[model samples]
Target: MTVEYAPGRLADLYGEPSRPTVLLWHGTQTDSRAAVRVLAESIAELGVGVIAADWDSHAADHGRADLLASVRFAQRTTAGAELVLVGWSLGGVTAAGLTLHAHAFGVTIAHTVCLGGAFMAEDPITGGPVLADIPASAFRAPFTLLVGTADDVIPVGAAEDFAAGLRRHDWPVEIVEVVADHGSIAGARYDAATDRYEPDDSAGTAVTARAVATHIVAVARHA
Candidate 1:
C-alpha cells in the first residue's frame, strides 16, 4: 500500500542536521504535526530532524495504516539515519505497532513516546477488543507513555493496564499522568490565536513536550 501523506514542513532549525531524527504522528481529527509544533521546534533547535507526518483526512482506520505508511516513508526519507517514533492519542498506539512493523520498512526504531495512547485491548474506533498480541520486541527499546488525569476517552484504568502489560512483556515502559483532558494530553494545548479547540492553556503541551524531549534524548544517548 502506497502511504498516502499530506505535505508537511521540514525547516532546518540549526545550521546543519547532525542530531537524531523523530517521526511524529498526530492524533485523530488533527494534522500530523498538530499540538506538537512547539516540541518539534525545540527538538529541531537541537539539530534533530523532525518529520511531522500528515495523512489524508478522509482515510482514518484508527490511524493504524497511516502510521504504518509513516514508518515506511520515514525509512525512505531518513535512510541510514537514527529514528525515534512519537505518537499522540491514536498515534501513540501506532507507535507501539511500529516497534514490530519497522522491519517491513527496513528501519531500526530506537525509541518511542506515546502521548495518551488509547492502547487498551479495546479498539478506539470500534470499541472491539484488540486481536493482535503485543510483540515481544515491542518493549526492547525505551518507551514513555504519557496520559492525562482528566482524560475521559482513554480511561485511566485502561492506561494502567496497558502499561502494566507492556512491562510484563519486558518492554521499558514509563507512564506519566498529567492534569488535563484527552485533547490537552495530546498537546492540542488550545491556542487563543488559532481558536480551533478548547482548554486554551499550554500547561499540558509544555510539560508533556519537555518530558518527551527529555526521554528522547536520554534514550538516544544510551542507545
Candidate 2:
C-alpha cells in the first residue's frame, strides 16, 4: 500500500540510522516523548536507532485509527529500511495490528515484539471478546511477546494464550518471561528515597532494550 506522507513530527534516531531502525510504540496512558527517550537512550547504548511515533492518546478510543496512522507514519519515515516494531501494553495490540497492515501493504518488518501486551480482549469465559483478532497471515514476520512472572495487572496465562494463538496461525512466535512485576516491564521503579517513581536501573532490564534491539537486528539481518 502507498504510504500517504504526513510531515512535521520528530523522529528520535539513534545509532547508525543508516542501518535498519526500530520503531517504538509506547503503552496507553503514556506519551511518546518520554517513553521513546528512555528506551532509545538505552538501546542507543548498544548502537541502534529508534523512531518513536507519537499518536493521539485518543487512540484508546479509536485504536484502529491510531494503528493505521502509526504504521503509515512508520512506513513513510523508515521507507526502504528494515523496521522492528515494539509495542507495550495497549501499544502492543497496536503493534500487532500494524504488522498485519504492513504485511498486507508489502512492507517488511524485521521483527515484532510486544511487551506485557494487552492482546487478549477479555476473559473469553467471562463473556468478553478474545484479545487477538488478527489472522496468521497478517503476522508474516517473526514475533516475540514478553510478560512478567509477577504481573498483577496482566495475567501471565493470558499472555501465554496469546502466544498459543499465534502459533496456531503458523506464525513464528517466541514468548519470554521476566522475573519482575508489571512495573518492571516498563522498567519503572519506586524510589522510596524520592517517594516517586524513578527509572529502575533494573526495570525492563530483564528484557533489556539491548536484548530487544538485538533480536530485531537479527531478524533484519536474516531478512
Candidate 3:
C-alpha cells in the first residue's frame, strides 16, 4: 500500500503490517522507492511487512526530516512492536546513526541491518562519520551488516573493518557476506545513464534478494 510518511513524501508498505514490520530505507543516489521494489516484495512474501520509504539525501537538512518522519510514522502506527530497520548504502549509515538517539524520537527498533553500507561517509542524522569517538552506550540495538562480496563500491574488507570497530565499542554486530554486487544484492543494477540503481529481474538478483529476505524474516521472528 502507498503511505504518506511525511507531507508530500510517500512510501510503499508491502504485506499486512499486522505481522512483523520492516521499515526499509533506500540509498543516497535517489530517494525513489522504486529502487527497492524487488527486495520489499521478496521480504513481504516471507510473511513480513516492508515499508520502502523515500528520503531526499540532497535536501537542505540532509533529509533528516524525511528520514525521521518515516520513523515516527512507523513507531506510532506499530505501537512499539517488533519493528526491524533495514537500510542500503547511505541509508544504512543513516539508520545506524539514528540508533544514537532513538529514545529522543520515542521509537524502539528491534534490530538493524545494513546492506552494502557506506560506513566511511557522513550519515544523514549527525552529518558526521559513523564511528569516531562514539560511546559504547550510544546504540540501542544489535546490527547485522550484509556485505556483498562482489561489491566494488564498498569492499568486503572495509565492511569487516567497520564491524570490527563496532565490536570494539561493544556494539553487537554480525557480518554475512553474499555473492553479489552492490546493486544486485538488493535486486538492482547500477544505471550509468541516471547514476542510480534500478530493479533487475535476473536469476542472480532473486537469489541474492531472497538471501536477504530470509535473514530479515528470521531476525524479525526472533526480535
The 0-to-1 C-alpha lDDT of every candidate, in the order given, reads: 0.60, 0.60, 0.83
- Count of residue pairs whose backbone atoms collide, per candidate: 1, 5, 0
TM-score head-to-head 1 vs 3, winner = 3
Flag regions of model 2 displaced more than 4 Å.
1-11, 59-63, 122-139, 189-223
Cα deviation at 3, candidate 1, in Å, is 14
Q: Candidate 3 vs. truth: CA RMSD?
A: 1.6
Q: Lowest-scoring 10 consecutive residues by lDDT in candidate 3? A: 131-140
**For candidate 1, lDDT tens digit of each residue in 75-105?**
6666656677777766676666666455544
Model 3 misplacement above 4 A: 133-139
Find the number of clashing residue pairs for candidate 3: 0
Supply candidate 2's per-residue lDDT for 211.
54
Model 1 regions lying over 4 Å from their true place: 1-19, 30-32, 56-65, 121-131, 135-139, 190-208
Question: How high is the lDDT of residue 50 in model 1?
Answer: 72
Candidate with the greatest TM-score versus the true structure: 3
List the candidate numbers ranked by TM-score, top first.
3, 2, 1
